[model samples]
Target: MPKLGYTAAQIRAAEAPLLAKGVPLMIRAAQALADHVTSVLPEPSASRVLVLAGAGDNGGDACWAASFLAEAGVQVNVVPVMGRLSPEPEAGARESGARILTEAKPVDAAQLVADADVIIDGMLGIGAGGTAAGGSPALRGTARDWALAVHAALTENPHPLVIAVDLPSGIDPDSGEVAEPEAVIPADLTVTFIGIKAGCLQGEGAKLAGKVWLEPIGASQHLLGVPPAVTVS
Candidate 1:
């Protein structure tokens, strides 16, 4: 059966109460992500996972997931594009012995993407816009550079599996429209939290999001409400 898709606003509303009650939503999300990552790899211990972490909760999820991967003996390297990371995630990554690349140049980023067996896109989430106008100049530049680097590497090898934390960086969670398609990180598989997003099933989303996986994280359907539209069967 096709999963129900919820808007960004709807997911936020559903998560609010759970967060208020002190649910470990981010931790749950990271665990689910790590499990899926292991499922995709032929040898979890031999795989190299590269995470592109932005400065937000989405990045935190990726950082935590990286920690799990590292603990499982996977070679994990995290590149913080936004130059900042949440304290909890930083601690998790540090304690797990994941290599955190604090200052990565363009060539360095490209090399990392080329060497990775799996690339986790945690640069942006539903709340942030992927367009040049919507984001700060530094962020927009960073996303664009990373996307270009990944594109180049894929053109050569096409071996690294790309996994997105939420919706692919630049896609609209509500409309599935992409303001900057070139800058969007295309995903081979996307692990979405709370519920399926409307954007993942429609328009550019269908093409950008190869295979979509939904993780409810204990959120109820009643709390998420009805979606504005459905784009998948």
Candidate 2:
């Protein structure tokens, strides 16, 4: 049976209690992401993965996943497009030997995308405007530039598998809108946590989110009685 999809608010509400209780949601989600990434690779240890991390927990999730990938022998390169990352996950990535590309240029981002076997998009999470933390609906600054680089690189070399952590960076998680279409690169697979998001089921979000995979991380019980905002076939 197809699962129901929730809005950002609904998912966040459900996650709150777990987070308050100090559940290791990010780590579990990262493990799931790392497992799925390796599952798709022919030889994971020999693969090169590029991670686009922004200034949010979604970025933290990616950084944690990078640590796992690095430990698994994958060459992981992380670009902090938003100039910051959640401290813990960032440290985990560094400790696991993932290269942190602090200097992010569009040209360099393009080259990284071109060379990657897989690209993990964790530039944003579900939110009303852009991020759950509240920002412009459209990607701005280095994030936009890097996204454009990714779009161009994919256009020229479409070999890399693009994986979105939760939601595609620039798309609205509730409405499925793309305010700046060019700033969002389509994902080959999206490993969303807790629940499927309504955005992934419709509009430009559906197009960008190629395949949706849910990694609930024990949030299912909390969401069990709560009605979903959207359902899919």
Candidate 3:
């Protein structure tokens, strides 16, 4: 079914109450994501998955998902786009046997992207400042390099299924605009949480997010009270 879309702010506001009450939102998101990933895998034991995780809640979701994938005997490799990962995700990934690469070079990223059966794009999410109209925004430092390398690998190989966490990095969750379309990870499937984002239905987001899947993360629609902005069949 086509899912209801909401603005990032609306989603945040709806989640605030649950977060304040210490709901396991991240874990729930990860579990749902892992379940979908497992369902798609041809052979779990032989599959290799790469997660490009940033130091944010979205990245945390990917990490937790990686942990679950690891427990299922999937070889998971995580590349931290930021310098350090958040404590909870880092711990979860390590405990579940997912290898967290401390120092990821361009070659490392290319190799991982090329070898993986699935690539989880968790580098950035709804909070990112999307690209301007005239040109693409510049990504600083290692994040830039990682984006470039991954983009290149995907373009060249075009094999592994790319699954974006929440929203694809470099996408405007509210507007569906992209700062750098070339650098953005084109998700074959985007497993969004809380509510489908408005951005996923229009502009560059529609093209970048090949197919969209919504996971509510146990948040009630009554609590969200988010009216659907648009719907895609």
Candidate 4:
């Protein structure tokens, strides 16, 4: 077989049936993400991990992973950039002792990024294609602020590792376009779910995404009949 890439729509289609069946895909993704983060850390108990969480399912995934990391004794801090949070996972994160920083200032957010041993970029995912009114895919509001902070901090120190939960927040998942390059934190590793996105392998996205790790989350069989949007030659 060949290396293949799927569009955001196709991936969503593949996920629909599983979600209907209530397969706990988010938990599975969270487990895989937490495992990957732990694997990269040299000392889990001593490390400071920051999760830049948005209001989407991607943010939920990060918050859930934060819970797992906190349970394992990693110092976990989550900034719900969109002000609102995914309540269930956020509750779990809090219960596991992860600090939920809801109103962090831009400078403080930057400092948090600088101080972290690892940063989980969960501010956006493929579902963040556009707004409800069909606007641009650029980062906005607190999410934009935090992304800029992460970019600046990383540029200065370059010490902390970044693990993007899915695709980087600002890049277009189908066209590989970035409306606000400054608002995107190029990942050191991206733990993508289901299939590899076509955009992640193309143009600026390839650069921003870094090493792409595909976590199936039990969606493979559902996607067997769906054709890829692009195929690597």
Q: List TM-score per model, in order.
A: 0.91, 0.94, 0.91, 0.95
Determine which window of 10 residues in candidate 2 has minimal summed lDDT.
127-136
- Per TM-score, what order, best first? 4, 2, 3, 1
Q: Positional deviation of 96 in candidate 2, in angstroms?
A: 0.3
Worst 10 residues of 4 by lDDT: 128-137
Per-residue lDDT of candidate 1, residues 89-137 (tens digit) = 9889989989998887556766787789999988888666323225321
Which candidate model has the greater lDDT, 3 or 4? Answer: 4
What Cα-based lDDT does every candidate model obtain? 0.80, 0.87, 0.81, 0.87
lDDT of 2 by residue, 53-113 (tens): 9888889999999999999999999999888888999999999999999976878866797
**What is the alpha-carbon lDDT for the whole of candidate 2?**
0.87
lDDT of 3 at 11: 75
Candidate 4 error regions (>4 Å) = 130-135
Question: Candidate 2 has which clashing residue pairs, if any?
Answer: none
List where candidate 1 sits over 4 angstroms from the true fold: 129-139, 222-228
Give residue 26's lDDT in candidate 2 (0 to 100).
90
Q: Which stretches in model 3 have alpha-carbon errors above 4 Å?
A: 1-3, 129-139
> Local error of candidate 4 at 59, Å?
0.2
Q: Candidates 1 and 2: which is better by TM-score?
A: 2
Error of 3 at 143 (Å): 2.0
